[model samples]
Target: MAVASDKTTWTIALVGNPNTGKSTLFGALSGVAQKVGNYPGVTVEKKVGEVVHDGRRWLLVDLPGTYSLAPRSPDEMVTVDVLLGRQSDVAPPDVVVCVASAGNLSRNLYLVGQALELGRPVVVALTMNDLAEAEGTKVDAEGLSRSLGVPVVPIQARRGEGLEALKDAVESAGAAPPPTVPQVFPEPFRNEVDRLADVLNGRQLPRYLIERLLLDVGAHIEDRIGLAEPDRLQLRARIDEARKRLAEVGCKTPDVETTARYAWIARATEGVVTHAGETGSRFADRLDSVLTHKLWGSLILAAVMLLTFSAVFSWATVPMDWIDAGFEALGGLVEGALPEGPVRDLLVGGIIGGVGAVVIFLPQILILIGLLTILEECGYLARAAYLMDRIMVRVGLSGRSFIPLLSSFACAIPGVMATRVIENRRDRLTTILIAPLMSCSARLPVYTLMIGAFIPARAYLGGWLQLQGLTLLAMYLVGVVVAALAALILKRTFLRSATPVFLMEMPAYQWPSPIVVVRRMLDRGWDFLYNAGTIIFAVSVVMWGLLYYPRLSHEDLAPMVADRERAEARLEAAKAANDDAAAADAEDAVAAAENHIAGAQQRQSLLGRAGRLIEPLVKPLGWDWRIGSAALASFPAREVVVSTLGVIFDVGEDVEDEGEGRLSQALQSATWPDSGKPLFTIPVALSVMVFFALCAQCVSTLAVIWRETGSWTWPALSFAYMTALAYVGAFLTYQIGTWLGA
Candidate 1:
């Protein structure tokens, strides 16, 4: 047996249609330890892992799952670039492991055939053999291998069956001669491709890319072809002529490829696959009927979402509270241990208070991601998207927009990047524009802070419903409602286009892999924590300085200091005499004098001055300078609003006996300077949450928009429109709520 041409390391690329146990096979091969990050210059995630077998290292690169090799968008083009070894940092695979579903051989083999045409060594790993057998279709691996002149191995990745044999087959195939390349285009179309290849002599386009170039209409692959201005015009003319000739011969450019491929597949699989049982699982069929039904499915989806949101509030409450208390104690410890200076303030006010505010919401973010992973694993997410398509279509979108929008609930950055899957430019831009309005995890801290503080924990319906959870749910719904309306208007006006037809392949329902779910949840959680430690940490430190700097002059502070000193003297005298009543009064007086100086110093800080300048603009939203300043400080990342609030309220330095809920307590006790009324009313909290909910406050999301759109115009437009909408929304919310005596 030849072992990959004597190379020390073999690159094995795993290509497959989705839901074919590709990821499962990857886990078994690489021990579920994969390095994940974005591919160079693209948003598509690159998942690669490695294993040492027989003293030879094999790098397993798991490509994204797709039905075809056609390159329509940048993300799809990434698949082609990797196969041809054009993607940076990824070596050409010695052998391509095309993971095919055993039961769905014909459809699964479609991508396998495409991979074969790439002129690389190809090995078919037939997965879901048990599912195939259950459906009464038995595939003879030897017979199929012989038919295609390639090795085929039937394996159950979940049970780890035939994995060793499959690995051996990959080794053998890598050293074996390349399999016969499958031709999917007709004779006339092939002639056109040949002619076009010769015409582009200056360009080193791959044979596979040439075929796709002629077949893929209105795709992004032309850029990958890299034709010069003159060459592009000449290439377009030649392509059009070739397409015309093929059309005259009744061989269409695109559909001809599909038709010819299936014809070849029909002959290749002859007498090899047998069916004895029903086509599919009866239980799954019946389950989908209820789950995908219009009326019942919609209700179930609503219930599922409500339960998910409810879990975020209920399940994450204890952990969040614990984290909050832990940070509070740490801050207090740092304060007492260090001297009163910038260094001590930096640790307590900047690090602990600022970063801790956002870190406290990690539990809720993790729970949400984990549950979404479960729903997606169990295959309900696809069905939910199918259900939402009806509403989406009315807004000039299809079910294809649902996944990206749903992803926004976790984080808008990924959600905005995911629009590459949609080929339509107008629809993609429209989706990206409305994506940040989906109330991503970045907004969760603001919502939790407001809802947990102001919304009463009243129970209804025999304790099934809680006011706080409902309030959280409403904030999310507000974002969704606004996104839908915005999408509708964008499609009708700026990004006007018809809703593209959505064709989805529903994956079989199965138990979610614990490894995948936990890894994903932890990955997202770590991202959250890492950001808190880095960008949010830096922002927090800067905010602390803005609030703490420009100390009161001696002339300005002498009177307040004297008052505090006098109160301290009285406290010492009363305590020495063991007069408990007088001691209590003196303690109150001392606290009052200290808080007064703290307030006076804050009013004179840099941030406070800026806040006062914008106070008039936001007064209609029931906000004072302090709230306006926090919003201004948090423009970089919406979650930083929590950190800003923590610094503003002197969270860890609350009244001596007040322990947990430090920020909330400070807000409740905060009052206007001129009037002693509370600063944060129910209406004010609602206004803040609603504003954060609707705002385009994340700088990262805007940058991604610029990258995806290849223009600064869209991001600028997004920021401008969303900011105005937020202000108006917040103003109305506060003004109306106050009128209703909220």
Candidate 2:
């Protein structure tokens, strides 16, 4: 390895397998001081944090977790390229710190073995030692260090234990000579690698990387190296000859390397590690008996999901209400302080109302994310995935895909971000395409409103279930079913590929640290607010402008003003006569007249015209121009539908008072202009709910999809397919319901 000569400021690369507490160590070492950005050409997160210890400064780069240096995906390719010093943006690390789990030593060391081949000084930070002791496994750190020819430090990153020692060890490695570990390959294979390396004619490539290129079939290193056409053909011929000779010697290229590496590791750890003989079941194994049970585990997973959703709805209700009222009071203050003009209107409607609509959902978002973090930290998420693997595999996905899809229940943006854990590109892309169909929390408001207004409060199963609650649950299930079918279809057609192997390590269950969970929640919340929230805010402003522009002139309200004047005069006359009933009737008439004028003005706005233009297309689904207008306004956010309907119905866009029946009352009492028949029936309400449940209404979801995929093609395809499915689903429901009633 080419180490930095100056060594004033060392660059240390932290590498490890997933779930080894590598991130926890990074956090403990760096605290809150870090910078996050995307890699130069890939969307994978690149985190660089600083560590100042003992008057020495270290720049630590936390690389993505990978099982091996073989580049199967862009994420792994980045990890390999950076460690190989091929990435131009980053300097090669002065020393490598491989964090390993004491409990899963053998598997963790597989990665460490690969790191040793990179020629950099390697230091092992062994974690989870306490858990290993509990499982009757003892690792002698000194002996293991001697065997591996490196310094090993035991650390409990969560508690900030052994971090100082780890730092010292890292510093020591930086000052030492670069390790020259010989290859573990058999003589025949080593000879083949030597021949291949010699063919390159003194190229600047490292010997280990050249060996990797020969072993990793169809690796990207060939493309990255930029070899001439003639040299590439010659290199290919040499690699084929090497493999043929190795096969004649009763050895396979890839399998032989894996066997040789493991054999060497076994010999190195033979006397250094000791295990209790055939002990009784440990806590994890015992817990897995029930948690990973096929039938009971599925039920447990369902109950967990139910509890999470229930908490999001129940616990967040109070905070959501508080936020709504606060914004409403602010809007009222703006109205009361300013005169009746366009400036006041824009502040009240565009800024406060539009922004508040998105902000009110923050409580639910935080609650959902916080709960998921706790579950993940406690390691129950892995068991949940294991339980769902059987079902997911049928749809061309592994158990790993379930976590991301489940996260979609809270929001599709984070769900898309969570797909980075899936190593296979085809699986990850397929998951991203269908994630939004999981019916996120944004659709909850629309679902609750429609069901409350239409579905009766009758109970079933001895009051254990209510008809309205069942309808809400059924809407969520519909999304789940549709998303599964869509995934199967996509895998079978558009993104078809062989199913990659799925292997997940189940860490021992432990109590999650509040600090860690809270930090993670805050990180995700900030990411959402920064990346997706900006797009939501901009879209909200555009929608507000569309609804606010083309204001009706004072002359246009002359007739309604005269009608209000007549009602007021009647009210005054009745009051003077002390006729309470007559005065009440006159008051109602005045309010109705004012509401009519407001609705008329809204109908003349730009958004209103666009809604009318699309009314014909939506008419078959039992939606009138007003409902269409609300739907169109909610394109930026699903929860905006309630506020949009309130605005269109002249209810003042404050729909938080559901008990007072403001927006629902308006919808129920509404009538068609031509037939004078009630517009919102049970069938119409069900159709609208179905459409919202399946439609791609949230622009935040689309933005995240674009960011994750690094292209617009997938997001565009997602929007098109989902919107089409929603229309068709709603159309069929409306037509069938109307026919049944007839």
Candidate 3:
């Protein structure tokens, strides 16, 4: 053990069994200084924080919770690395605080026992004291503390109790003398663990190494070690012999040494533990009745999902408007203050417009994550998964896929990374492949803009519903329907296999900690800005250049510029000659007149020439050249379709302008030259909106797909399949509508 020095900061690792409120305790101990980041070379997140306890500032590492030291997944590998000091980036923790849920002492101590075996300073924090007491159960805290050779403090973490005792134990551990005696393991298992340790002599080992040597089930562990073929064969033979010896003595060969550790823990826990009658908590029983009911469960899940989508659109509108207005004002500020040059264009057009395109969508992401975190923390998420499991199973997906799918509603990268939980390799890969097909937060801006611009606001079919709202709802449904259908096709064809079984342990329902919820939302928001925001910015720059440069020689544009300048000069001279009130009246007339002339010139510019060139090809689909160009711009990002239309129609970047104040309205009022019909007719707008809805219009999504799959093959296939689907779907919609005289 290292001595605590004035210059050295002690490292404390928060370790506990699963479902012991360790995360809550970590959040309580280290609040704002905590950072949630990914562990190196893996997507599994690590949280590190600093705390001042007993006049000492300690760095705390919150290790992932596990049932035992036996590593089962990638997340569990993090716990193993930190405990063994094997992670090069993080120092081994100086002290370990094992959080034991009072209601489940025996199981919790199994982890504590294993931690103690590592020969580190260990303190036990007994959490959920109130829950135990409410169930008429009592734990002899002091007696148990004596038996375990450590200090124990009873804590009701949610109510802020016994925090001082926990801190005192940490301080005492920092200055304490090392124990002389080593922990003894029992019988045949002890001998076998020793044999395995001898086999691993002079080599650094994972915490779960001994356990993995016992089970020999998964290939991942042994693969990491690169054990020789002969040595691995000998190890397997020794494990079989050990299992046979244990069976002869009427004992089972434990999967991990920690299993036997827990057996001893159970014996030590006797007499100090008692269970209450009925064996169930009232709150849990009540919640399960409604939340887990087969019929009501599905209905509640549907209602919750519907409400979440509706709230995402309705609630985020005000904040989105404010963000839009702020960007617009900032753009105008730059244009007014800076001299007319590349710097001004860069500020107003390139940087502001490109960044604003992504930033304005932040409110939608925040609201969506907030709602999701509440549902997840409140225990409804598990029940929703249970309800969806039957349908998911039919498509060769486990109930575990539900969370990833739900996460896809926010972003696909996290959703793809989340598939690490599905133990089956085939199922996990399939989930990763299809996750991007589900609509994401990035698609929301496109959906809202298109639906608002194109779909009629008035209700149809005698006020049964607003056609526009239904169209928006239908767009969401299209993604869901396509995703499910794609899963079915993939399962039946390429990734054909048995549907993996879903086995989940549901947690007791409790109110979420507001601090944790807010932290989660902020983490997600920052992740979006840092990850997806950068890609959108770069793509926007390319798209902006594609539409902006190759200027008409200024010689070609000189005629239009000279004409506009002469007209503006005449209007200014007329305003100067008039009286003050008359000049104000003339100002409005001059402004509208100038706007119309500029709008016309833009329509005849190079972009307009290209739109006209492409108009014939798109005319059958109910789009003129301008709509065609907007659709083309939407390839990099669908939301760019909205802003591009604004630019094309000379509606300055103000997003909140409505009531004949938006370019979409100008589009709606404009007529086709040859057809003598409105360009944005009901069928045409719906078809275009539908096209935007289903396409892979996000570069970030494609990038994530590439990163996650570790190949461009899947993303390329995804793009091809989705673009084909979008075009065909839009084509069918347009043709059918025209046939019906829509």
TM-score of each: 0.93, 0.89, 0.82
lDDT per residue as tens, model 1, 145-246: 998889999897766789999998888888888887866666787888889889876688888888887887884577776668897887788888888989
> RMSD to the native, candidate 1?
2.8
Top lDDT model = 1
Q: Which of candidates 1 and 3 reaches a greater TM-score?
A: 1
For every candidate, C-alpha RMSD to the true structure in Å: 2.8, 3.5, 5.1
TM-score of 3: 0.82
lDDT of 2 by residue, 1-742 (tens): 4555456788889999888898988898898999988788767778899998667788899998877777766778888878877777778888889999988898888888888888888999999888787788889999999889989999999998999899988888888787768467888988887787777757877877788877877746787678889987888788888888999997787888789889988987999788873242365677899889988888888767666655655566588667767777888888889998767766777666655655666676687778878998898988887877887888999878887898897788768887987867899999999889988867876876677667776665665556666677678888988988998998999789777666788877777878898897787567545533465556555666677678788898898889999999999999999999999999988877876776677678898899889999999999998889888877877877766665555433444445434456668877775686889988899899999989999887898899888899999999999999999999988899898982
* Error at 25, model 2, angstroms: 2.3
User: Comparing 2 and 3 by lDDT, which wins?
Assistant: 2
Candidate lDDT scores, in order, read 0.87, 0.80, 0.71
lDDT for 106 (candidate 2): 89
Clashing pairs in 3: none
Model 2 has an lDDT value of 0.80
